[model samples]
Target: MKKTLLAAAALAFTAGLAHAGDTVRMGTEGKYPPYNFINDKGQVDGFERELGDKLCAMESLTCTWTTNDWDSIIPNLLSGNYDTIMAGMSITDERKKTIDFTQAYYPPAFSAYLGKDAGANIKGVVAAQVGTIQADYVAKSGATLLEFPTMDDTIAAVKNGEADAVFADKDALKPFSKAEGGDFVWAGQEVQLGEGIGVGLRKSDTALKDKLNDGIGKMKADGSLNVLLKKWFGDETPTF
Candidate 1:
């Protein structure tokens, strides 16, 4: 839910609805592990990839996937580069002002601190991915914020001692913290942000948005969404 200047043509395009059965393009940042990431085969693979496919099948929509850098994700959608954003985007009022969202597919999860240090230095330098909720939090917080273009860079900042800690979605950082022989550790209390993760769409694609919402509802009702959540995030991660 970040970045980009909307062109006038893009704003005008948002007034038109997409035709049914048109090929739907699913946009993602294929760098965030467990959410959307490029697999060994150089194809998008992750929880969202699986989830999006299921939703598409349920809705009977022809779907395709594409990757974009996180910073321009929303703008690309508004400009019609993609039909939906399946990136790990949260539902927030600030983001809602720019684009509409389908109902949440993932539940609200905590953002946590990771570092070599034992506890977080709240007022010290903290690293977060640029244009993320965590970055916005550190900016408003008393801490000095160190922004990076990617999630991996934020962890690198902590590793290289540029920041006291990296704050990010706890699930996104779990593999690092629990890695064998890794030095990173959970540094502080987990902070919750946003409502939950959802599929982002242009305000004009009300039809697609409705189809996605209905498919998500079906998943939730049948417990299939929870299965995906557990498969990616472990049972300890909350379910719908």
Candidate 2:
């Protein structure tokens, strides 16, 4: 009886170990600047990366990040190709139907960039990259929509007069606008986009979702979240 009880206890301990150290694969579009972009050394580095690292550390889980295109990210997550997504995806009603999201990690703000000759007639003008929230806004708002695979291409389209304007997160647009001298200008006020950014997880993975949220709340309370935000956005805390 003593030996049997010891074996049962060992089995339970092994199960707990398996549950605690589970590895989570995170998906990201490594093209979005200051969020999850690829560095010159061919490594993924950005705000999302830092946040993911912290979450994994806090939760005692191993994390692996996979870089993928923006359009296929959601499908990939749903297919179980990854365990979660830390791609700075916003929590939207449309997406909530398909997957669950953790508490927001960053705020959302939208801005538009126009070419030198382009006036502020944003109506009917093509703006935003494909598969992005800005593109969704353009489609729903009856604006002429132009889609590009990457932010660089979208910026190039505006600079070369191919597209009238490009809309994206304000933080992502700031560096490009500054580099353009008088060639480009931000038009209109920065619009409050939505309820910040969050980690996207599979709908059935409620356990992992709870863990991520708890980790985020701890990060917020300890000021680690703010430290990471300042590293990426300088003095500005993005509007959530």
Candidate 3:
């Protein structure tokens, strides 16, 4: 009963945003757990969701959440499907060519190779989500890179033996690796990647960008950002 109510509330909260004042529609890929995911209540929940909400509150802005497939997240944002992206999107020079980013919310973390064969060659065929930094890195790693539209498919490819291993954000693979028991293990050295995770907005949205930057400054000043970061990602999540 409680779950049902929460689900209803989640739907209503998100669906009613069009009627709210100063609503900022946030775009996210909801499949990445611990970052952003659809919770048991069918609501957007996780680190970014929490942080986005707090940031909106700080800026005195109303906000709503929408989930878009990772592959189309940026395009959809460009199409006005949402106001900004709160997905676990890294700030990158290549990506910056098309979209503007706010100050990084999370430091650039490392990517690792995961596989069933503990002894698999790091140079073997590897899988990564399409268009991600991991995919970009794999292309230059002398490994046969297999790209998938979503993180789930990348992991599925390794489990189904289509790829020798999967490379992605270390933190993203943590829960799955822990839950899979001894099935999957880290197979190679983790490579540091990207500048950090940041909120993506259209390049022309300088007003909104400045507002968000100010809100981020406030969070950092009062230490709420670090508090939420640790609450979701634990003590090791870098804070500055």
Candidate RMSDs in order: 4.0, 7.8, 9.1
Encode model 1's per-residue lDDT on 177-214: one tens digit a residue: 84635678888788999999999998878888899999
Cα error, candidate 1, residue 230 (Å):
0.2
Clashes found in each candidate (C-alpha, N, C closer than 3 A): 0, 0, 0
lDDT of each: 0.88, 0.77, 0.85
lDDT of 2 by residue, 1-240 (tens): 999999867754443333345788778889887888989988888999888988988998898878988878888776566778887687888899998899898866555555443365566466677877778877776668888888888888777777777778777776776453435777655667767789987766788889999999998888888888888887766532
57-129: candidate 3 lDDT, tens digit per residue: 8888888899999999988877667889998899999999999999988887878888886686668889999
Candidate 2 has which clashing residue pairs, if any? none
- Candidate 2, poorest ten consecutive residues by summed lDDT: 11-20
Worst 10 residues of 1 by lDDT: 1-10
Q: Considering only N, C-alpha and C atoms within 3 Å, which residue pairs clash in candidate 3?
A: none
| Cα TM-score of candidate 3 | 0.88
RMSD of 3: 9.1
In terms of TM-score, which candidate is strongest?
1
TM-score of each: 0.92, 0.85, 0.88
